[model samples]
Target: MARIVRKPGLRRRGSFRDWLTMLALFAAIAFAAAYLGGSEPLRGRAIVVDGDSLEVNGERIRLEGIDAPEYRQSCTNSGVEIACDKLARDHLRKLIARQDVTCTALGLDKYDRTLAICRAGERNLNEAMVRDGWAVAYGDHQWLEAEARNAKRGMWAYGFEEPSDWRKDHSGEETSRVSAKESVTLHAKRMFASLIAWLKSLI
Candidate 1:
C-alpha cells in the first residue's frame, strides 16, 4: 500500500504561491479603488475664495502644496501694517481673471475641501502664488519660495506669521499641520535612500 506519497514541500510551495497571488490581487484592487474613488479633475471658471483656495463649478478647492495668510490676517512692512491676506487674495483673483481654471485633485483636506493643483490657462496657480510670495510653500515649492524671498516679491517684502501659525494663534488651537502628500513623499524618499545604501553595502 505504498501508492500515496505527496511531498510536504510541494504543498508548502503551492500555499506560498497562492498567498502571493492573493496579496498581489488585493494590492491591485486597493490601488484601483483609491484611483477611482477620488482624483477626478475639476474644470470651470474659478471664483477666488482666498489666496490658496477657490470655488470652481460650485466646488471649493484648496490649492495643494501652498498656504496663504488667513483672510483677516495682517503683516508688518517697514513700520506699517499691511493687509497681506487681501493682497494675496487679490493677486489670486488677478491670476484667474475670469479664466477657465483646471484643477487636478490630489485628495481632500481635513476640512473636506478638495486639495488640488490648479492652473489658469498655462500657468500653475499654486506655483505662481508661492513664486510671487502671496503664499508660502507649505509642502512644496521651496525653491520658488526662496526665489520670491530673494526677489522680495509680494508678502516676502513684509513681515508676516506663517499661515499655519496665524491660524493657530487666531483659532486658539495648537494645530501645526503638514501636507500628508509631502509626508508620504518624504518617507518614500528616505526609504529609497535606505534601500540604496543597503544595496551599496552589499556591493
Candidate 2:
C-alpha cells in the first residue's frame, strides 16, 4: 500500500480561503453597523422631510431634541394666515442648501425614525432650527429657543400651537398613530436591533 501524501500548497490554499471568508464576514458586519446602529455617523446630502426630520442616504432621521409643526399645521403672522409647517420645512431646506449633512444617531423614536443630532458643515441643525424658531426645543436647546423668542424670529413672530399640542389635537387626522401593542412591539424591535449592532461592532 502506497502512503498518501498531502500537497503543502493545498493546505495553504484552504487556509487562505478561510481567511478570505472571515474578512468578508467582518466587512459585512461593519457595513451593517453603519446603518443599523453603533457610533458610525450617517453622512450624505439630506432631504428635508419636515422641519425636524431629514432623509439622508435613504435613512429617515428625526432631529433629536427638537420638534417642529405638523405638516398640516398653520399659524398666523401679523393676523395673516401662514402655512407654518411649510415655512419650517422650507427654512430647514434653506439651511441645508444642498450641503452635506452628517448625523450621529442617539437612538430611535416612537415612530421608529432614527433620532439624531445632525449638522451641515459646522452648524448643528437641531440648534439652528430651534434658534431660528422653526422648531421648538424638546429635550435640548432651550437657550436657543429663548434667543429666537426674544428676537421674534420665525414662529416666534407668529402665533402657533406647540408641535406637541398640535399633535394631540389632530391625533385623529395624524396617520402615524400606532396602537399600544404595536408601539411596544416596535420598541422591542428597536432594542433588539441596537443590541445586535453593538455585538457586531465587537467582531
Candidate 3:
C-alpha cells in the first residue's frame, strides 16, 4: 500500500477560501443593518403621505408624538372655509423641503406605519409640526402644542375638530364617499401643491 500525501499549497488555498466566505457573510450583515432595522438609523428623502404620515425610501412612517387632521376634513378660519387636513400636510412638506430626514424608530402604530421621532437637519420634525399648530401633540408634547394654540398658529388659527375627533365622527364615511378617481385626483393636487411650496421655501 502506498502512503497518500496532500499538497501544502492546496491546504493553504482551502484556508483562504474559508476566510473569503467569512468576509462575504460579514458584508451581508452590515448591508442589512444599514438599510433595515439595526444600530443605524433610518434615513432618506421623504414623501409626505398625509398630515401625520410620511414615506421614506419606501417605508411608511408616522410621527411618534402628534396627530394631524385626516385628508378631506374641513374647518373654518375667520368664518372662511379651510381645508385643514391638506394644509397640515402641506405644512409638513414645507418643513421637510427635500431635505435629508433621519428617523429613530420608536415602534409601530396600529396602522402598521413605523412610529418614529424624525428630524430634518437639527429640527425635530414631529415637534416642529406641533409647535407650528399643524399637528396636536399626542403622547407628551402638549405643552408645546399649548404655546402654538396660544399663538393661534396654523390649524390653531382656525376653528376645527381635533383629528382624533374627526376620525370618530366620520368612521368609514371617508372611504365610502371618496371614489377611486377622486382620491387619485386629490392626491395629485396635494403633491403638486407640495412641490410648489417646497420650491418657494428654496427662494
Candidate 4:
C-alpha cells in the first residue's frame, strides 16, 4: 500500500467559521433564487393606471385586493347625480401623483388586471387610499379591513352609495323619471362642465 501521510492540522475537520461561511453562501444563493423568481412577473416599464392602479409593461394592475374609486367607468346614472365615484377617483389620483410606485403582483384577476399591492416609496398605496377615504378596501376579505371599517372611508361614508354594483338599488322607485342611460349621459356632460341649461333639466 502506498504511504498516505497527512499533516496534523491538515487532517483536522473544518471549524465553525468554515461551516458558517458555507452555510451563508448556500443561504445567499437560495435567497437570491427565491427573490429572482418572485420578482419576475412584476418587472417591466411601469405606467400609471389611475390612483391604485399601474401597468407593468401595459398590464392593467389593480392595487392588490384594494378597490380605488370607480373612474372612467360610470359617473352618472339615470340622471341622478352619482358623484361619489367621481369623488373617489379624484382623491386617489391626487394621493399617488408623480410618486415612484412599486407593486407586488399576486397574479392576473378576473378582469384581466394584475392584482397587486402598490407602493409609493414607503407608503402602501392600497392602505393609504383606504385610510384617507380615497377608496374602498374592496371585497369582503382584505389585509387592511380595519382601516376602511373604522375610518368609515370611501363608500362607508356614503350610506346610500353602492360600489361597483348598482343593481342592488334597482327595482325600487327610480330616483327621477328619466331613464338610467339618459341620466348617466346628462351627468357626464355636466361633470365635464358642458351641460346646457335646458339639457340639464330635460334628463
Candidate 5:
C-alpha cells in the first residue's frame, strides 16, 4: 500500500481560504445591516397644521422641499382679494383625507420640527403640493413648480404673493392668530380630535 503523502502547505492554504470566505460573508452582512437597519419607517394619522406642515404622533414635521402660504396670507386673483393661505391649507386637507401618511425623517429644521419627505398613499405630499401650485418648491422640486406654473394650476391660476414674502410682511402675533383661528374651525377641530384618538389608541 502506498503511504499517503501530505501536500506541503495545502492544509494551511485551505484554512486561509476558509478564513477569507468567512470574513467576506461577515463583511457583506455587516454592510447590509448597517445600511438597512437604521431606517425606521414613520406612519400614522396626521394633523395638518398648514399646507406644508403637519403633526404625527405628537411630532411636528415641516414638509421638506416646499413652502406653502402662511395661514393668514392673502393675494389677488383677477383683481379679487383671495385668502390664498386658507385655500392652500384646504387643498392639503383634501389631499390627506382619510389616508395613512408615511414619512422618512430627514432631520430637524431651525424651528426644531422634523424635516421630512411625506406621502399619503401613492402621492408624495411634497411634490403633489408643488405640482398643484399650492406650495412652492424649495429644495429640489423646481421641476414640479415649473410644471404647475406652465399648466396654470392652483396658485398659478390666480395671481398670488409668494408665501415667504407674505410671512415676511406679517407680524408673529398675526401669524399665530391665524393658526389659532384655523385650529378652531370645525374641520380642523375634527382633525385634532382624530389625531388625539389615534394617539390614544396607540397607547
Candidate 6:
C-alpha cells in the first residue's frame, strides 16, 4: 500500500476553488450593477406641480414620492406646534408659489395622485425645502425623515421656535410680514444655489 503525503504549504483544492468562486460571484454582482445603472431618465413631462409635487410631461403626473408639510395641515410633537399646518402655504409662497417648475414622474400613489419623484433643473425641489428647514418630512419615511432630523433641517431645526408654537405666545402673528433688507434676499439666493448644487449630486 502506498502512503498518502500531506502538503503543509498547500490549502485543500476545494478551498482554492471556493475562493475563486467567490471572486467570480463578486465580479458578476459588480457587472450587473454597472449594467443596470443606465443613464436614461424616467419618461415623463417634467413640470413643477407645486413646491413639492410635479407633473411629468407624460400622460401621467403625480406628487413626488416625498412627503412635505401639508401646509394648511398640522402635526404636533411634545405638545408644541412642531409641525406644519396651513403653514404649508408659507412653503408654497416661499419656494414655488410662482416658480415655473418641472418634475420627472417616477411612479404613482394609492389615492391615484402621481407618485413620481421630481426635480427642478438638476436639484430635487422636494428635498431642497426639506433640507433648507422650510419643511419637514411627512409620514413614516424614516430615511428622509432621519435626514431632516439628523441635519436639523426644516422645521426640525426650529425645534421649539415653530411658528405655531410661537403663535401661542403672540397670537399667530405673521412674522414674515416684517420687512427685511436687500442683503437678506441676496443671502437667500446664494443659499438656494448651494442647495441645488448639493441636491443635483443626489440623483
Q: Which candidate is the best by TM-score?
A: 1
Tens-digit lDDT string for candidate 2 (111-145): 67777889999989999999999998856589999
TM-score of 6: 0.39
Stretches of candidate 1 above 4 Å error? 1-38, 174-203
lDDT tens string, model 3, 1-203?
Answer: 99999777998887876776666556544543453432356999999988778899999988877888888988897788899889999989999988999998765544445777789999999999999999988677899999999999998888999877787788943312222234334444454456545544443
- Model 1: per-residue lDDT, tens digit, 61-151? 8888899989799999787999998999999999988889999887556555777899999999999999999999966799999999999
Measured on C-alpha atoms, candidate 2 has an lDDT of 0.81
TM-score for all predictions? Answer: 0.72, 0.68, 0.65, 0.49, 0.65, 0.39
- C-alpha local distance difference test of each model: 0.81, 0.81, 0.76, 0.54, 0.75, 0.47
lDDT of 6 by residue, 59-150 (tens): 35433434444334345566666446444445644554444445443333433344434454555666666566554444224466567678
Point out where model 5 deviates above 4 Å: 1-39, 172-203
Q: Candidate 1 overall Cα lDDT vs. reference?
A: 0.81
* Minimal lDDT window, size 10, model 1: 182-191
Model 5 has a clash total of 0
Could you tell me the TM-score of candidate 1? Answer: 0.72
Q: State in Å the error of residue 135, model 6.
A: 5.0
C-alpha displacement of 43 in model 3, angstroms?
0.7
Candidate 6 regions off by >4 Å? Answer: 1-51, 54-61, 75-83, 133-144, 158-203
Deviation from native of the Cα of residue 56 in model 1, angstroms: 0.7
Error of 3 at 40 (Å): 2.5
What local lDDT score does residue 104 receive in model 1, on the 0 to 100 scale? 88
- Pitting candidate 2 against candidate 3, the one with the higher TM-score is 2
Worst 10 residues of 4 by lDDT: 174-183
Instruction: Give me the overall lDDT of model 3.
Output: 0.76
Span of 10 residues, lowest total lDDT, candidate 5: 174-183
